[model samples]
Target: MSCGYLLQMDERPTLDDIRRAPKVLLHDHLDGGLRPATIVDLARENGYEGLPTTDPDSLGAWFAEMSNSGSLERYLETFSHTVGVMQTTEALTRVAYECAEDLAKDGVVYAEVRYAPELHTAEGLSLDQVVEAVLEGFAQGGRDFGIRVGALVTAMRHQARSMEIAELAVRYRDAGVVGFDIAGAEAGYPPTRHLDAFEYLQRENAHFTIHAGEGFGLPSIWQAIQWCGADRLGHGVRIIDDIEAGDPPVLGRLAAYVRDKRIPLEMCPTSNIQTGAAKSIAEHPIGLLRDLGFRVTVNTDNRLMSGTSLSEEFAKLVEAFGYGWDELQWFTVNAMKSAFVSFPERLELINGVIKPGFAQLKWRGARPVA
Candidate 1:
């Protein structure tokens, strides 16, 4: 059944209902989603002594607080500890496995988790070793958790290893790696700086998404899409700057192009707020972009940092924008469509998993509570 636009008066997805529906995640970070207790355990096991707090509760709160400092640069610094402990093969595999388990528990049927290999090579392991350990963990996690998790080998935009990482991503494409990405501070480290990696992926028919228009502005986005030819825009919230609000809300040339081509905007509401990308969940560009028919999909950029899951993200939107089952389902379908997977696989998940799951929720919602 196709997704309906109508919102039944009593049909908005509660936090409980949202948790039961199938979902797809296109933008998420591996290091950014570790369980706080796991971090403490890894630090102890690895003999790495850099955690701000040994207590798991304080460490979890520390991540959320540090990430909420309202500066993207400072927010990114929180990764040092996570990346520090993740240097060992065992540490990397455990984190990846638990990531799959956690997402499955939250009802995420599919997710593409991206991580930088160079970040995990601090301990003398090769980049291939890092990727292999992560892939193995996710493979085991998927079997145990009944969820599908794909890896997107990421290259840090601030660093110079993008070409090598792009090659690595292609090498492991068939072995659970789905795509490539450039993630980091989007300001000084423009996507154009790594044009070689993006061009190389393009020439080889590989897929990639660029971190653009998040910490920077339109020039970053233009460079990613027009120059490097990114397949999707990671946190393209700044595209809202190009539109003039009015009766029809006139879109500028760049905005028009993005909308016309259906470029997927991987908007992470809580993370955006934490990074000062938006003021709050209620005033996020996602609401405007969704209303304007842009292909906007919701995501939990960093589950631990944001102290949220996919269900919480959707629930926040429901409280902020009064979203119902139809809106939630539309976002799920949009994410499945924007996924780096093959068309047939995306279609199967949309039809066989997402739609049926939401249909059941809506049917139950339209009836009185038992």
Candidate 2:
């Protein structure tokens, strides 16, 4: 299991080095990580031609550009094309299967992909049908690739169907749906708008995460956790704003509570920069938060938009924050600990998958670093 080149001396670290480092992904989006070639083919097959470029590479770049315009609403527009082609069961299954294969290849042992079922029902599939197709794809992919996958059925913040989506997620809990989430614009559509759904989820003993502190600020995060009962905070990057850099920055009440409670922060470094949530990757507060004992996990919010994979995200963190195998392993464990999967299953992943992977990755030979 020892790759002689596991540690590239003096190069920082690289995707290759980290690719063998077991990781867990908690915040990836299904419609946000479609293969460029698949999108092109899907679009062509469905006779829907609205893409800026037909070529796979060019279309990939187009999605990235469209998502980088500094406006959350504008960034979400890119998904119109992705979700458009994902309406059919076959397309959804293919995307889900490919998503698992990609994560497996990138060294992720566990992943939970989230998407709003309401958005994919445009082609007449029921919520149950969409969930079934996605689970089928994930199950097949996991069986084929050895990557454990889970689904999060999200309710769009702008919609009034949170209760329905929460029910769908709870209903499929036994069938591989791990949790529920609220996505879309966070500024106007606060988690309070989905209180009923959150309440129902809590009563049903279902786990849920919330999209907060990404587009909005501390108020949004506070409401999501304090009010709506979110288990984790998606891109809770703005919690830093509530912090005061007395000499080296002080965590406010909310930040301190999040840290003390061990609420996981699903931080996507490149995606935060792309969405203007963080000015730069080096300036991201994840390092500080992690240093302060906040459960911080790296993620690819949208691979296509951020032009990043799980390995790439880890490589960037190493380059920017001097993270080594220990820190990388810590992040992986943090993710697994914070995942919505059951306690026994999560522990199994850590002991059986992550620990062994890192044991092999901490090599001293010639692996290339950043």
Candidate 3:
């Protein structure tokens, strides 16, 4: 008996379909996704004249171009401007608010947007104040736009404030903060350096993800999971290095452990390409990871830097792999399941929003293929 699944899977999803499909984002950076116009306005208001261009279009292009340098340091340098203008309370709130609104418009039903609070304290705002401002903005934006935005309080790995940030994250757990993370250059500044923070979160039963396996290699991934006990791996594209493609792909000890443990990998395809983690979207390790039944989730590491959204990421995947609604739904569900939100809330979204959203699109373009 024909199951009819192949018929619906025959046609590729269009951009519209991709946009309307309910999406979940796990690794987006708040400082990395500001509106170019907002950056310009904030820069001028703050009397900061460091922007490469005052023109919004040109500034946006410049951010993308600078990020495409294939050097993690250069890609990170783009944040100096975004973080520069976000020191004040008003600026932080506005940026947070708009981040939620933009994600809602792109059909991201749930997102755990992260930012390093330490980076926003240049103008004397305390870490607590910065967290409160961003939380307020996320609350307002969520109420207005009908999307759930959970803030991940991040500590720069190179800095000495991971424990402080982890405490801040726990303090705001009930308010809006969902988890904790350490983000920045992964090479010299390993996750082990922030061992105190990870240990604290673990003791407090708070969830956290470590930025690993992007700029670095398996050692980074291994330490994040084994030593630090990250709940998820941010930009874990380098985990691909351990898997040797064969008739039946052979997984090294680390790879095998990751798959066996069902550790969630937040794979950001375009951002990986931009940072030299992957050659291109078509050759991204996400494809192989998904095929191997690893718990993989799609993400926009930085929408502004990669010039991408959750919908755009899914659209690119479809274009590269010819995925249909079912595949998209699978990825969405995987993200929803891996989210730091409470189990009941995750179930609510999976059943209430995501499943129904994709079901409507599943048969829209299906036709019999000879």
Which segments of candidate 1 are over 4 A away from where they belong?
1-8, 368-370
Q: Which residue pairs show collisions in model 1?
A: none
Model 1 agreement with the true structure over 1-370: per-residue lDDT tens digits: 4443433595577898899999999889999999999999999998989789999999999999899988889989999999989999999999999999999999999999999998988889999999999999999999999999999999998899999999999999999999999999887788888988888999999999988899999999999999999889999999999999999899999999999999999999999999999999999999999999999999999998999999999999999999988899999999999999899999999999999999988887663332
**lDDT by residue for model 2 over 83-157, one digit each (tens)?**
989988999999999999999999888999999999998879999999999999999999999998999999999
Clash list (residue pairs), candidate 3: none
* lDDT, candidate 2, at 305: 78
TM per prediction = 0.97, 0.95, 0.97
TM accuracy, model 1: 0.97
Worst 10 residues of 2 by lDDT: 1-10
Show pairs that collide, candidate 2: 5-367, 8-367, 13-369, 13-370, 245-249
Candidate 3 lDDT score at position 156: 92
Model 3 C-alpha lDDT per residue in residues 1-370, reported as the tens digit of each score? 4445335544688888788888899999999999999999999999988789999999999999999999888899998899999999999999999999999999899999999999988889999999999999999999999999999999999889999999999999999999999998988988999898899999999999999999999999999999999999998898889999898999999999999998999999999999999999899999999999999999999999999998989999999988878788998899999999999999999999999888777766666444
- How many residue pairs clash in all the candidates, one count each? 0, 5, 0
